[model samples]
Structures are given as C-alpha cells and as structure tokens.
Target: MAAVLEPLPQPDPPGAKTSASTDASHASGSGLKPIKRLISDSRIERIVPESNAATHLQYCSQFARDFIRADYNFCAAKVTVARGGKIRALDAAFRESGEWLGKALTWIEQHPTRSFPLEHEVIELKITHPLAGRLVRCLTQYDRIFVRSMEVLLAGKIQSHERETLLLNAGKRLKHIVQVCIPDNDAYLTDGTRKTK
Candidate 1:
C-alpha cells in the first residue's frame, strides 16, 4: 500500500530543522522500514508494467516520438533556426512526449477493455481493430492541438501564425497500429494472434 504522508508543520524559522517530531518522522516511527524505501513493486508496476504494458507502450510511444520530432523539425526549419537549435528542439519534443506516453500507458492499463464504445472486455478479433483506431485517437490527444507557448511569445506580431503551422505523420503510424498491430489490454497474449511488440 502507498503511504499517505501528512503535511509537515512549518518550522520556527525558514529552513530551520525542528527538534520535535515532524510528520515525516512520525510516519516512520516504527522504524521497521524507511518511508522512502516503502514503495512496493506493484506501485512501480502500475507506472510501467514489466510484463503486460510493454505492447501498448511500444506502439503508442513510438508514434508520439515520431510525431513530435517531425512537427518540431518542420517548424524549426521553416523559421530558419540554426541546426543546433533544431536538434535541441527535437530533444525537448521527445522528452515532453515521453512524459505523456507514460501517463497514457497507465490509462490504458486501467481501462483494460477498449474493444467497443460501451467499454467492456472484447472477445472477438475484428472488433479490436476498429477500437484501437478510436482508442489511440483519444490516447494521442487528437482533439487537443498543442501550440508551443515559447514559439508564440517569441514570434512577436508578424510571424505568429506562420510559426505554428506544422504537419505530422502520426496519423499514418496510428492507422498501422490499429489496423495491423491490434494491441491487447492483456499485457500477455492469450489468444492465437501474436502481438507485434
């Protein structure tokens, strides 16, 4: 079980160490296990599963990474950014998308069943194909158009709209994942169909 740490009281002086029992010290009063070391394997597994979550994570993360890199590179080049700046932008894009991918994987794990609109376990093979197309649409933030704040803030008045216009190949990869890969909610492959990941 995850420890619910209570907030610590304010110290007499800023950054001063309290001689009395703090919330952190009180929570681990038993001394049986350190509070920082108390995180369980299940909790870690919930973030990134060792066995089952890999398949979905692989496809979805790849698509996001590719999409971000492509979009950033295009914008950078169009704006006459230096090659080094473009490279740095690509790195930033991947890092941001990686954070999103981790959250997306956790959501996929919890939802479990994505074969239909009603959100139940799917038994048939055909249903999964169409469902991935829809599920990935949500997973990839399809409706939310991300506009970089720095780009807008730096563009001043003249280049604002031109700087933000960009395209991505994520749709092609998404189609391939849904139509061909058919990722299962089960981390393991139970049926005869082999998982690509």
Candidate 2:
C-alpha cells in the first residue's frame, strides 16, 4: 500500500527560506492543468474499513502515499500526514492556529455508519517555494478529492456533482481560511461583514 507522504520534485532547495512573492511565482507555474488532471483515485474504497478501522485507516494512508508517488512527478517533497487526532500539533507555518481546519472537522462530523471512532485526516503535500502559493491558490481543489473519496467510501457510488460541489465549497472554505490568517488590518471585508473566515 502507498503512504500519503509521497515525494515530489523540489521546487526549491530543501529547507530554503521563502517569501510570499517567491511562493506566488512557484505557485503560478505549478501547471494547474497537470494537478487538476490527476484527479482522486477512483479505486479508493474508504478511509476506514468497516471491520477494522485502524488497520484499514493505516492501509489507506499508505495507499494514498503510493498513489501520490505514482502520480505527481514534480511534487518536490514528501507529503505530510495530519490526522484529526493530531490536530493539536499542527505546523507553525500557518498564520492562524486552528483556521483552514474545518475540512477535518466537517469530515468528522459527517462520518457515518462507522463502528469505530475515526477523526478527520489531512494528507498535505508541501509545495516548495513559488509552488507554495500555487498550493494555497489551489488548496480548494482537494475539497473535491475529499468529498469524492467519502462518497465512494460510504455510499459505494460516486455522486456526479460531488466533485464540482466539493471544489466550489473548497473555494468558499479556503477564502475564509485565508481571511483568518491575514491580519485584521490587512483583512478584506465585503460590505462591512467579515467574510466566512
């Protein structure tokens, strides 16, 4: 089975310092077409197994890693695995401590028919300089992957609009997350309302 932390080509040197502008440049060249084309695996059955959730979860995590390894050649670095159980120790790169995390929370809330306790899981692939911006820009893309994976896992059938809706929802969610990360003075407000962030 593949692990979720699949490696990709390094956009910048390992441990290289980064700035927002550099990240934007890398992100701009990330070739949205390629990343978008590498849609979620149609073969994933579920995040957790019906009989043995832990064993199955581990198996799935490893499988996700393998899938990433096979799919993204320019990934530049090993992916990171952060499960709901591990949320308290999130990386400090994030400006806000608990923002951009509703994905996991929502997943945990909506999980159904599981015999064992399973929290949300995030398999993050670090985007090197320049590419980091691309990651942030395209962060919402994963919403489709998450939703589709869950649909297939529990319903045993993929919803036609699940991907689109997920992507759209991701955009909304991500904007909120970014807003939260930005400083109050630097934040963008529409019509005196603090957007969803």
Candidate 3:
C-alpha cells in the first residue's frame, strides 16, 4: 500500500525561519489594552483587503493560481476509495482565504451544475510545475466542479442575471465580513495576522 500526505502546518510554512511565542504577553508589551479595531467582530483572514470584493477576488484568483504552483504533496496514493484528501486540501484553502469561501461553497452546493467541462479552454494548458499536472489529474469530476465554481465566484463575472445564481455573491459578501474582522496590529504577518508573543 502506498499513501501520500499533504500536511498543512497552519499559519507558518514548514521551512519558515522565525521566532514567536504563543504567549499573549508577547503580543502586548505591557499595554494590557485591547487594540481598537474597526471590524472587531470576526475571525482573521489570510488575504488583506482594500475594503472591496474586487480586491478580494483578485487575491482569491491569485491564491488559487499560486496554490496550484506550490509543491505540497506528502506521498503518492496507491489506493483510495474516494478523494477525501483532495477535498480537504480545498477546504483548508477556503478557510485560509476568508470566511467567504465557506459561504461560496454553500451556494455552489445548492446550485449544483453538472456542466463542468471535462476539458476547458480556460484551464491553462501550460503548467510549469510537473507535480501540479499530476495533482490536477487526481481531481475528480466533482472536485473539478467545486473548484471551477470557486474560480467563477472569485472572478466576479456576473453572466447570468438570474436571481438564483446571485447566491454566488455570497462569496463577495463574506469577503466584506473578513475585511472587518482583521485585527489592529503594528506588524502584519504574511497571512495578515498580528504576530503572537
């Protein structure tokens, strides 16, 4: 039996060289005061915003594109019953990008469209990374549908003026919520969170 693992170690990449203390004290140098925040009401987001969905969409597309470029597989799968690992990877990405990702997913779930093409002109033919090609191949038809839905949502291209399809806007709306939840900090980490002590 052969198995592959893709480990997501949280906010920090595995090879990052940095020192941080999980201590709250390190976060606040004796000020002992909660920083006033504009959003003050939600979870943190990995992408920063210029206070608009357009910006969020830009980041989202790049997030997908860059993610496709990264080499993060842990092992090759010899046998599998389903594509749980692939689904998990996508879920982790959504959570990291913003709360909106989950919202978008919900909309896609309800608005199931089997029209996802097995071959599309938009899927870039040139993938420079060798590993990404195999990764792409492992994607199930359902997985492809889900990802394509996200790509469309993040692209913000409103083609159908149908009200039912407007649910795609949920991603944009959640992105707004993310904008408010960002913490006030002197230093911003790569993922846009304040450094912990």
Candidate 2 regions off by >4 Å?
1-156, 181-197
lDDT (C-alpha, whole model) for all candidates: 0.30, 0.35, 0.31
* TM-scores of all predicted structures: 0.21, 0.25, 0.23
What's model 3's lDDT at 132? 24
Give the TM-score (vs. native) of candidate 1.
0.21
lDDT of 3 by residue, 67-111 (tens): 222311111111111133433333343344334444445555565
Off by over 4 Å in 3: 1-63, 70-98, 119-197
Provide the lDDT at 156 for model 1.
47
Candidate 2 C-alpha error for residue 54, in Å = 31
Worst 10 residues of 2 by lDDT: 50-59
Q: Who is ahead in TM-score, 1 or 2?
A: 2
Candidate 1 residue-wise lDDT at 137: 39
Instruction: Please provide, for model 1 over 125-191, each residue's C-alpha lDDT reduced to its tens digit, 9 standing for 90 to 100.
Output: 0112222223333334521222222223344422544423321332333333332222233322344
Rank by TM-score, highest first: 2, 3, 1
- Give stretches of model 1 more than 4 Å off: 1-82, 117-197
Model 1, residue pairs in steric clash: 52-187
Pairs in steric clash, model 3: 4-75, 5-75, 21-197
